[model samples]
Target: MPTLEVNFLGYRIKSPILVASGPASHDVKQIPIAQEMGAGGVVLKTVVSDKFDYMRYWPRPRYKLIDWDKKMNGKSQYFTLYSYEQAYSGSIEDYFKFVKISKSTSNIMIIGSAFADEPKDWIYLAKGIEEAGADAIELDISSPHKPGTMQFETHFIQAIKSVVENVKIPVLVKLAPGPDVLHQAKVCKELGADAVTLCNRLRGLEIDVESQKPILHGYYAGVGGPWAKYYNFKHVSEVYNEVGITISATSGVLNWIDALKYIMLGATTVQVLSAIIVNGWETIRQINEGILNFMIEKGIEDLEKIRGVAARNLVEPDLIVRWSGEKKSGPRNVFDDW
Candidate 1:
């Protein structure tokens, strides 16, 4: 079998398949299942400063699918997508118990996903996570569902800056893909973010025109799934080449092809959130199996070799060795050349 190991956010893992921060990773019970199911890493469900503040271990909310490409600027149709109206809420003490149980594995990364409403809250949570035996921290400053919930790159740099000053472990800031993506990542690095996860979610909504109502109960929510992959791919490519921080591409990544494309484009490792929701935890093994098969076919033994391989090709598009390319003029017979 081809070796599928990869280094992400300064830690080497058995594979590049990481479970993104979501309800799937909210408890210690899920962590072992994730590892047993062949996940390369697990970013723990986010822990907020408030423990038992609102609710405790709320059941993972269900997702509502809407046409992902309903408003695409061009030819694409039928985006596999959904909206999450619910967000997890737990107290600090419950999260600590979660961390303690997740630390049993020496290799699987137990990443503490966290956020805060104030600068002091950020610092306090960072210190707590460091002592909680978490391998690293995924600073989730980019959840689009709760608009004014937590202060991240755009709303409040000071909060992130506070956490950076307080933590010694690797910290990754999740951000949205936009013109300011590079700037956001740069700012994160400037404030001591070890790496940047390309996006949290794109704020979008699906509405029932016939019923004249919003499809989700939350009024609006972050859009995710395979449909978001193209935009994520472009954003990741731009950041990899333009910025110096390590990038973890998320959003819309569903298969090994999507994962491989992200690796070539400069993401050190990619994450799967919505795909996991749709496909279940077993998806990680399938992803690893596909990645290994591809690597073996290419006579490659490690996942690291393909990392950022695509970034170098962006400058010289004609120099690409395998995949065929055509100058995309517009919507006109784009597939005609194929």
Candidate 2:
């Protein structure tokens, strides 16, 4: 039998599929559910500092599933999860208690997620999370719903530095999906971060045509779909190529294939949320089963054998064969010479 076990931040997990920080990971009650569903770990819902207290109150009807009913081959296929959901809807103290209780009750790895602007606040939250017995801490600097004008340059660098310095546990930095991702990942590595979570959801807006207004709370919301994995896949591959930091790929993993794609592109683990929201908790178990079956068929005993294989094998642009631009007839690949 093939094993789904993978090591993340030096901690062994039963599977590489972690429940991403979102509504599915907001409550302590969800911990046992995730473990039972065969998830390796859960990045607890991001908690904010007291200064960002207003982020705790999310608007009612915050979730909207756009194009969810679209299907192919008699199966629901694509969707855009647009949401205005913010940080964990609780005080920092409440979050501390939540982490403490979850850590005590759950056998699976529990990582506490936190978002804050100031270095002091970052240290405070990191200390609290460490005190709560979390196995690790992930700095949620790239949350789409982050407030005010906190950029990675002026704001997050110091906070990340402080958190890494203050915490005894492994520190993972969750970065946004943008052109600067590789640079930010390099910075995380230089600052002593143990890992980087490639790509958070992009901030986006949807409008109602009839009302001629923004839909769902009249504000821009975090947006992601299955297509998101493509760019993040590129990001993971590039970051893995250049920065070489541990990566926990997230944003658009909907199945075992998606999970395997991340691992192939150099991700140590894959985080999933939108899939669970749409497909139910069984999705985790299903993905684990799918991966195990694939490994067994491939005659592989461990996942590490395939990790980063695709990234390492990427074809350089200069080496790619290009079409000769001589009015070619019939069908041919863009890279194929006429």
Q: Model 1: residues >4 Å from true position, as ranges? A: 51-62, 67-79, 85-87, 148-155, 316-338
Model 2 alpha-carbon miss at residue 34, Å = 0.3
The digit string of per-residue lDDT tens for model 1 on 138-238 reads 87777765545544444558877777788888888888666578788878888888889888787777778888997646366667767677887778887
Off by over 4 Å in 2: 323-338
What does candidate 2 score on TM?
0.95
Q: Please list the C-alpha lDDT of all candidates, in the order they appear.
A: 0.74, 0.92
Index of the highest-lDDT prediction: 2
The alpha-carbon root-mean-square deviation between model 2 and the true structure, to one decimal in Å, is 3.3
What's the lDDT for candidate 1?
0.74
Q: Give the TM-score of candidate 1.
A: 0.84
Model 1, residue 170: distance off in Å is 0.6
